[model samples]
Target chain A: MAETTDLDVAYVARLARLQVSDDERRTFQAQLGDVLRYAAKLAEVNVQDVEAAAHAVPMFNVFREDRPRDWFTADEALQNAPRSANDLFIVTKVVE
Target chain B: MTAAELPALTISELQPLLRGGAVSPGEVVDALQSRISEIEPQIDAYIALDFEAAKHEANAADLSLPLGGIPIAVKDIISVAGQRCTCASRSLSNYIAPYDATLIRKLKAAGAIPLGRTNMDEFAMGSSTENSSVKITLNPWDKSRVPGGSSGGSAAAVAAGAAFGALGTDTGGSIRQPAAFCGIVGLKPSYGRVSRFGVVAFASSLDQAGPLTKTTRDAALLMNAIAGVDPQDSTSLPEPVPDYTQLLGREIRGIRIGLPKEYTTDGIDPQVKAAVDAAVTQLQALGAEISELSLPHTEYAVAVYYVLATAEASANLARFDGVRYGHRTEGVANLVEHYERTRAEGFGAEVKRRIILGTYVLSSGYYDAFYLRAQKVRELIRRDFVEAFKKVDLLISPTSPVPAFKIGERTADPLQMYLADIFTIAANLAGICAISLPCGFATSESGTQLPVGLQLLASSLDEARLLQVAHAFEQSTDWHQRRPPL
Candidate 1:
């Protein structure tokens, strides 16, 4: 188990793509620190031979025969987009 | 029956009236619309209502279908084609679903009208609707207190007679907790029993859409339409769907019911404990064999749930960047700034808090300690249920540790609010079917009468037996018949 410590809220916020204000950073740091401390209880449990379960019920991969089917038109697909031009979603420039 | 009396009828009761030519489906919609206009100011249950379109659909409803002519309110998170699927977040506040969720499609095929979108905790994050970016849904029983949340609006709408039934998604006790608070029947079918194709994703593995209604039979009736495999959601099970109402009036003789010792601890309110105890006795008198058992890992559920659910949430919510849909920041220099600012502006505080926590737990070095460890502990929790179910057909407990608390009560402390779902979270972790129904009432110090819920759990895909037992208990007690003073 990794040693528990204060959460670096600013760093985590940046990683999450969420811009946190200075006040929010301070509040979140304290609150998340408390939650992490409570979550540290899991470290005490013996899990030597246990398998990690990503889902509660066992699931199997489902596949269907490859076939072309009618789906959303470009207009329907772009209906809720924040910005769209032609048939594609518009966003901030990625490459210079 | 007069139009005023139509809102008080359950889906099952309304079906006969519609079939027997006594009432039209459009009249039901109008009655509910009138009721909504009268009580909605106090409850604030619905986020949006489109009765014009609902009445349009109701006019053509086929009475031959199972749920014919019933108007089921939908939680804002589920897509219903043209309706706004805001998820009670500013991020998706103006967004409209381009297509219906598989569950909505099934309900429509069963002749049910999708009435309106109800409020919820922002992105289904908090225990109380106070976390909702839209509005807080007050408990219909006591307007000063909260309708326990994420699905608070759905439960309150049903309890207040503004909706015949409603759809709610449960990740960790969202449906059951609110239902317990509002004094209604809420079912969380076993994971993967319902499709998640168009429902907004929270914790993908844990979330299941189910019914919030006035009675167990109504839940069973709604469940019959919603449960089944869907090609759109890969995780949905391929098992044969059964008639959920098949065992409704069957005798529960010799049915083994277990009471978990871990759940009977001191944190539970005394009134809540007494209600569940009396419910156990009632079930015993109805011929169920009650015994004490242990699901030893019960204490770690909230901890494990927080870590895993938040981790999954962080990944799932990444789709909300300012590109394809929803909110977009006006001024930004580049892609990175656009992503950051848009999310910061769009998501509410609780959603942001969870996103940060999720990212941290799944971050470098701490992954093994928090994320993976929680998953392993999650396995242990599931195993505990598996072992206990071997000795009993079902388990019983209080859905929430306490009844509906004051609106601003737990808002200051997130952990305190998370603890309110103590009893209901374990079933989601264990991938089991569970139901919360009205068992009794708890009177607050201020002299407000609040509803207490009795929770029943059965192994995965055993909804038939779960509904049977819940129906038996509900039929024997007058609890389901008690109406709020609205």
Candidate 2:
């Protein structure tokens, strides 16, 4: 039996802070299940004792000199937002 | 300025006219705007085209840049300084970028006007632009069908005569597939060939920035402008960027071109097969040697790509919390709900599905069975290309199995959608260089007329050689000259 449920989809969306419509929730539930159906093929291989490979271009723990650099200013950062309050993105206190 | 007559003059041809004072950049920009207005109702190529701003840029650019004033389109996922970088997601719909992407800076430095951000699959997650949260981008070749995506908007923009060239990102064939579907040239350079500093990440591991143009030489020219290391992205290669255009006229006299047997196996389109074979023959005529090569792990490409891409998407998307520039839900009293509601509302079905699958695969219990094993398979797939590269200078294959399908054709089936990218995804996974150029025509199941693409791939840092092959074949064919009936 598949280990997925409508609640799992709803829960995941909730965790992501997205408000999905009922139609969207149903669409995602089925689509996500089908996507997982193909993704389950990874379970067939034996990966014990194998090291992990992350980035396609191989790099390991890329380090910088730790010198402080002045990144974009707060005013510049918020320049493109539709709304901002006190140098921060303005959003409704969205919690249930 | 109908689409029929537009394909004859490449960006290189048009730029010179603008530069030599034979034509004003404003005239060219106006011609494109007029054509876009005429056909965009049916094709739906652009999410936003800043025609007024572009005209201003073109006027200013004529006096400053080398190309008098060539207009360029940017994939929606990338930032253009102060413009909106939506990635076709509602989450960032209200967000505008604070700075330009490295390539956008480079394009502007070269005097290209950014018309506006083109539409894309939401978060650059799907093969078809149908996954876009904003709006769907249709193929310019046949308005009813899909332009290969997440760069679908870029492809459609160029295909429909909205612009001469455009920039696109490729994680899993986003650039090449759409270019193929739209009958243009798309190049995905070596992983570090272009910096990803301000381009929104979908799958950082395999994601790259490259060009979509009307010809391979234009791709090369754009590559020359865009390719290089940047201080912003540390993984960017520090090597000197080579001159790609100079290599076009040179003969590939003794270069070895390899045809991968796995690519030509069952389920291959007969027309695509014939077209690629003819391209191979043309390469031979151009004094290049051809050989049959085998990549045994070809079947594992899709499996490897999905696992790795999703795992990265899961991590990269975590930054879109309510605290940032993107959308945040209101009326939720708590912080946790803030994150949940914002994402649930912002992300599309495909993105939500992938995030869940990605999270599930990387979760504790399934880590060993899924993520670790998939990494090992990735190593094996990369090795297959490395071994094949030792035998041949370049690999040839059909870019997509069939031509473009209708808008709703494969939307219902998830895996079937993924199958379209089977051939083009391998190069991204392997971190190699690949180019897709127009090959010939493909008749769809419904008797629709579409164009097929032939992909030329090479090992890492071999873009010069790949472009040489593409440019050589393009010299022999008139397929690149064909455009939409509009």
Candidate 3:
């Protein structure tokens, strides 16, 4: 496990698109450090020959006839948008 | 049953009454509404109750259907069209669901009324409902203690007679742990057994929605309504659905039940261990064979779960940016700042902690060490179950290491709280079916009785046997009939 001091909490939080307060950063750094340290126990297991399993049950690709089906209308889709104009979700200006 | 007593009856009990014209569906809703009004203030089990809508549905309920007119509370995380799908988070506090989750759609199709939205940990993140951005759901047994969470509110409502039965989602013990703490039955079907469509994702690989109910039979009845393949959820198994209640009265004369030694180690509460041991003896008396077995990889389950579940959560929750449905921030300089500030202000401490940890593990420098390693260990955990089931029909243990702890007790220490779910996480990791039912009760430090849960785990798609055994044990004991002082 990486040392607790080694985790750049602010940088990771930014990567996660979260803005943590200084207090939150300090608190999460300690709490998450402990969690990661505990999780480090996984390294002791001999997984050299074991293949990683993403889903416990084996999955196969499912297919259906290529056809459209009834779904939410445009108005219904944008009904929950925090900000919308016409049928589009309004957002902060981009590509400035 | 009189109107005053209607709210306390289980779905199985009320079904006949509703069918016989002895109790109208409208009356059931009225009785439940009154009962909810009386108990909800103390328990805070519900986030929102829509009596007007529920009554309308009840009045038109098709009595011929299985769950007709039965009112089931829903965890706020699952979408119920036109109801608030807050997920007990401030981010979606004003967000009403535009569509019903597939599970909700199935329940309604079976004639069940979606009665109220129950509180939960923010995005179903915490073991105790203390992390809920809304109000804390208090244990019905003792208000000083918490109802186990993120399905805490659903479990509490069922326990306190605020609702007959409720829907809960289990990612890492969310349903079963709370059900254990509240002294009810909670089932986590084999991962693909239930549809996850429209249910807010926590850890997609781990999450499965199931029932929290007053009796195993009610759980089976709910399971019958909800479990099936859904084209909407690609991971939903294409396996045929069974009559989960068919094995309720079947004999278990030669069924092999394994008791994993690791689950009974020193960290468990003495009384909890005693109760589970007694339950094992009772199952033996009922003609089941009990044996001690090892699931050596057991200790690493919570470790692997936290890593994988949080990793998935960090990705799943990315959709909650300010541009869309949930909470948005004002006065942000740019889109990036808006996303950061919105999430920062919206999520609770535990959610933030998990997101950060998840982000760190998946980040460039640590992916192979943390995320990949956890998945491989997760496979080992899954293999442990696969190997154990070869010799035993089911595995039994205490659902939680201890009963419901007092509210605010473990909130400050996240790791301590994480460890509380140690016994229940492995089932999710293995993607197997499991259930928790009230095996017995233990007196707390203050002498109040708290429920102890007996967990039963079966191989993937073995819910029929799981329900059969749980029902047999439940019927053999008075634990399920014991009501809280409330």
Clash count list over all predictions: 0, 19, 0
Q: DockQ numbers for every candidate?
A: 0.89, 0.43, 0.85
Give the TM-score of chain B in candidate 2.
0.96
**lDDT per residue as tens, model 1, B247-289:** 9999999999999999998999999999999999999999999
In order, the Cα lDDT scores of the candidates are 0.93, 0.81, 0.93
For residues B1-486, what per-residue lDDT tens digits would candidate 2 score against the true structure? 443444346788876667677667777778778777887787777888778888887777743465448888899988897787888998888787888899888878877888867888898888779998878888877778889798999998888777788999999899999998999999999998899999898888899999999888889878888899897888787789888887897778899988888998788778888877888888888899999988877787787787778878888899887565787667766777667777777777788777876766676565656677778877777878989989889998999987787888888877788878899988987899999999888776667669889999998888998898788889878999888777
Give each candidate's fraction of reference contacts reproduced. 0.91, 0.53, 0.88
lDDT of 3 at A88: 94
Better of 2 and 3 by lDDT: 3
Cα misplacement distance, residue B142 of candidate 1 (Å): 0.7
What's candidate 2's DockQ score?
Answer: 0.43
Tens digits of per-residue lDDT, candidate 3, B35-126, equal: 99999999999999999999999889999999999999999999999988999899998898999999999999999999999989999999
In model 2, state the lDDT of residue A35: 61
Looking at model 3, the pairs that clash are none
Q: Which stretches of candidate 2 lie over 4 Å from their true place?
A: A1-30, A43-51, A61-70, A80-84, A88-96, B1-8, B62-68, B445-447
Using all chains and alpha carbons, the TM-scores for the candidates as numbered come to: 0.99, 0.92, 0.99
Q: Score residue B162 of candidate 2 by CA lDDT.
A: 74
lDDT of 2 at B261: 88
